[model samples]
Target: MTTTPALETVGITKSYGSHSVLRGVDLAVPAGSVVALLGSNGAGKTTLVRILSTLLRADGGTASVNGHDVATQPGAVRESISLTGQFAAVDEVLTGRENLVLVAQLRHLEDPGGTADGLLARFGLSDAGSRRVATYSGGMRRRLDIAMSLIGDPPVLFLDEPTTGLDPQSRIEVWRTVRELAGRGTTVLLTTQYLDEAEQLADRIAILHEGRILTDGTLAELKQLLPPSRVEYVEKQPTLEDVFLALVGHDTTAT
Candidate 1:
């Protein structure tokens, strides 16, 4: 018998009025693997995520998380999954510690304070936990937002553009966190525009274009689809990111 994937979708489609957002897309993510969904801004990445996470309904097709149908078994799907949206959703007026404590209490986890403290420390925000989130740097707030999602230890996670405003160092910190989570058998589906981030974290990568998947495969498998490189006569040049940053003047002095 074939095992159900940790996350699976067959011919998933969505539309906003007359504007089609997803056009019969299909994907399957295996247990304990990180799959990156990549697309340009309006390629239906967020729309697909919303449907799978049960925040929105698919206009067509079927999706399941941990063997539960997202359309008919939303509660079961929710019990097994967590989503960190593009924006930081923490309460600006609350302290970092308070935000975590609130989620812990709502989840009815015992010893909320200890749990909050542990998470704060894990995210390297222990010293700043008492400060109101209004005073946090963008990276700090982003870290706290992710920590809040980990409170219940959900087996599946959907991170939608999770590191958008973070600094380079904080981005690496979150990458390590994701690697550890997958190592512990948690499945992760990440939607991102950052090519290198996907290269670093994803065991498999899927690209969405015009509401359908362009390709979905392991990095090596995907690379094989490209035209083989011609023999190089000169040393390889610097990457476009290096040239862009140098030309645009990346501010090391600012966070």
Candidate 2:
């Protein structure tokens, strides 16, 4: 039996005047799995995400989330999904716990305080729950933003360049959170420009280029597209990211 996709788009098109952002893009993401929409800047990844999130209308074609048509049933589509954008959306004036409480209350969940506390613990922000968000590190702020988005427990999640501008350790923190979310059966549609990020997180990867999907497949499948390679011995070196992570250590307590 085939499982229905949690998110899908077919012949999806978007344009601004003479400039086209998405040109007949087609893609599908399986339920409870992460699918990375990898692309360079201006590759229409954010446009597709906005359309699916009901934040923007598509010029043509169709898209859906959790089986609800994005065009015809936008309310239902929004109800089933959560969107986290490039920057953290937390209120700097509010404490971490207060931010979570605000979202829970906005979502009209019962026991909003309890919900906030639970989310704080889940996101490993419990120790800093009373601290103002202004004092939090980039990683902490991003984690709090994500925790707020989870208040409604939306089945589908759209993370649009979630780690953009974050430090290496912070990026890794967000990555760990994404992995945990996927483990709990959340369907994630992650848009990213980072090849390593996609390779690390996505169960399947789709490369969007020139407003179209250039390729969509597992990492190994994508590698097979290149010509057969001859073996060559190469010296191993720690990458900048590796050096940074090692020097900074993995402790979040300093934040």
Candidate 3:
């Protein structure tokens, strides 16, 4: 039998008093696919995530996680999905292993300790398993936080700016992990401000601006929305950076 979409939002709208945050936003994420929500700040990315995860209610329309409605069936939706926000939520007082164990226990796993240890190893935190989260580096804590999110092995994962504060190496590491998760059939809805990140990881992309989706399509399709890729010949070898600067007419290094 065919499975339902891992996530779906139809005509979702949200507002803050007189200020509208989302206006009839619609989205659908197929099972085992990675969908990147691309937007600048105040574009309603976080608000969308919150509503989908059942933390906030939409003013209109509806959303579902694995066929469970976010409004009337929030508990079922919560059981089928996991969310990791921009900031790591690991407890400073708990050890890396302890945090994972806590999550497993909350999920009512039969063997929380074993599951936690396995996750610690998977995220390369085996050596730091016993170390207090307070002493772990930013990357390590973020890894642990993500590990905790996977304790239940939920089918749908929502990652919102997960690499925001990480160093380059750590960001790459997280990217690899995300790719691996999607490869293993986890439906991922990722929100990121980094255009390059979306280009690299998204199977499909949706651009959000001013609380509405400006466009949604594959990377190649989105590229087609812009001008055609131009070819410039030069005697010297021009780097991708140079090409980007020539095409976009802005110094990428300055940002």
Q: Which candidate number would show the highest lDDT if scored against the true structure? A: 2
How do the residues 1-255 of candidate 1 rate in per-residue lDDT, one tens digit apiece? 113489999999999889999999999998888999999999999999999999999999999999999999999999898899988899999999999999999999989999999998787789898999999877777778888998888988999998987766557667877887778788899999999999999989999999999999989999999899787689889987567667756542222
Tens-digit per-residue lDDT, 163-238, candidate 2: 9999888898899999989999999999999999999999999999989999998899999999988999999999
Give the Cα error of residue 217 in candidate 3, in Å: 1.1
The predictions' CA RMSDs to the true structure, in order, are 3.7, 1.4, 5.9
User: Highest TM-score: which candidate?
Assistant: 2
Ranking by lDDT: 2, 1, 3
Q: Residue-wise lDDT of candidate 3 within 12-128, one digit each (tens)?
A: 999999999999998888889999999999999999999999999999998888989999999999989899999999999999888988888888899999999899878778888
lDDT of 2: 0.92
Residue 92, model 1: Cα distance from true site in angstroms: 2.2
Error of 1 at 106 (Å): 0.8
Error of 3 at 138 (Å): 1.3
For each candidate, what TM-score against the reference?
A: 0.88, 0.97, 0.89
- All candidates in order of TM-score, best leading: 2, 3, 1
